[model samples]
Target: MIDPVIERPRLTRYARGGGCACKIPPGELEQLVAQVSNRVGPAVDPVAPLLVGLDGGGDDAAVVELDEQRALVTTADFFSPVVDDPYDWGRIAAANALSDVYAMGGRPLTAVNLLGWPRESLPMELAAEVLAGGASVAHSAGCHVAGGHSVDDAEPKYGMSVVGLVDPHRMLRADAAKPGLPLTLTKPLGIGVLNTMHKATGVVFAEAVDTMATLNRDASAAAVATGVRAATDVTGFGLLGHLHKLARASEVTAVIDRSAVPFLDDARAAAEDGHVSGGSRRNLEWVTPHVDFGGTGELDRLLLADAQTSGGLLVVGELPGYPIIGETTGFSGHSIIIR
Candidate 1:
């Protein structure tokens, strides 16, 4: 008889949704959210002390009035292995966590590691390297590792819970975009396409991979230098999907210029060849109703929902020298310029 052990199916312990950039298809997602809907009106939360939890649209976990004058902002982010290198994986995960603080106009002060690993499959040395990678970024952000939690799973996972401080007045919210606010994206899109390709065939654009692995330290600092009103990091949902959330929460609509947006050159071809990740396609369908395209190329439209991991900051406001590639208005759906 043939050996059943050798014929057993291979087990993989990871998910397509890496980190904050989960790919929920636009069309079906809308239906699901509609079925389990909330009472539409003003947000009235029972918890009063929590100034910015889910209600205020701030990234991570943000609390206020713990002290009379200072508000405490915190966030946690983690993901399964996106790359083979343990160090790079840890670095990207930590960067993703720190980004939430920067998005809320805060600086990170502390972090606790979150780790999951397959004890028998992967080596503890590799996990240590991943933590080292994460620690490097956290150290650079002026954050020290306070502590963390770890679990043994079938795959390797790592991230951090970052604690930060934001002034009550200067805290930025995702739903604070004003009509005519300029939409400017910091890092180029296409990480989702490239990474998906990597997973399927082990191919990737070095630039996109590097950007994904790199932290938001410099970009966030540059944005803060420019003084942005509202911002959010681009992750699982792709650029337009997250933008749609900002618009919906703020009761506005977004208009993007397909041409002006920056993207990795080769990514479009990959997306055109139908190399898109599951998350990317889901993102496209989710924003279909509210998203209007003015004769944009097929690839261009697909690029809008290209899921990302540890992607750049999408900033909306009137920051000089930052060209207005898109706009948000008090309308019900999305619009764009053809030419």
Candidate 2:
């Protein structure tokens, strides 16, 4: 048991970059991954042909078919605090990590905690709170969270590595979108801006906190139930970045209606107040060349390209409770058309 006498420090203070915005830039990551993937060459599978490989075809999680009917899905994700509350931060991180599995139409089976702590500076009790938070969410998903490895680090980081089960025939994929299919986003955008504001001023927004901590299980189940095959979770890459990837992989173009997109309360206000993060701005820059920003301005672009943490699943077909923001079109020179 952890001692209760230890002092609780402000967790966000130790974070270098908050939330999913800490990820490597999309453009640079693609270039570096290309070199590594080329060096490793194609993987040879004697049992079953690879359904999704790293060549920009796979969606969130990697899947290996175990049999004609079953497949194993694996993914890992972690980040520093996006909010000040230790428990809430833990919940948000766990949900974000598990989202990859769900996006692939898999149900979590087991998870292992991934933690980095400044043991000398922060008390172990606080870490326990974080752990408890993660375990609570994992339990809700009917997943087992067992003991995991922890490292001594300068900052506090938390998340999980998850394994899930899926049907090989019903799995959702990033490369399966078709022309004329409607696009729907399960959650609102602007998380990155809200998080930036929180990091800067220590002000709390309950709505953003609740949104981030919520799991994507229902959304995933809905996507699979509705016979949707193409989907990707909107996280560090932002909506536009992920949309660009979806369109490119599916060999189609995306047309998003800027007016129809939804945002968390005060999200637009945060961006208008210049609370945007560098990661979010980078997302806009990466997709600028490929997007047609017809009448959209800087604020709208920033909101659309805002880097998000545990954001939402962007599905090709419509599902109940989600807004239809765009539709797929035949391949065009521009990958994204924002009007």
The best candidate by TM-score is: 2
Candidate 2 segments exceeding 4 Å error = 1-8, 43-49
Give residue 90's lDDT in candidate 2 (0 to 100). 84
Tell me the lDDT of candidate 2. 0.89
lDDT of 2 by residue, 139-200 (tens): 99999998788999888899999999999899999998999999999999989999999887
Per-residue C-alpha lDDT of model 1 across residues 1-339, encoded as one tens digit per residue: 112455421111244445444434555655665554454543477333666755533343565645555678888888776655567778888888888887777788899999988788666887888899899888977899889999997666788888888766666677767777778787888877776665555453678657876766665566666666677778877887778777776767777777777887678777767778767777777767667766776677778878888887778775444445677766754533223
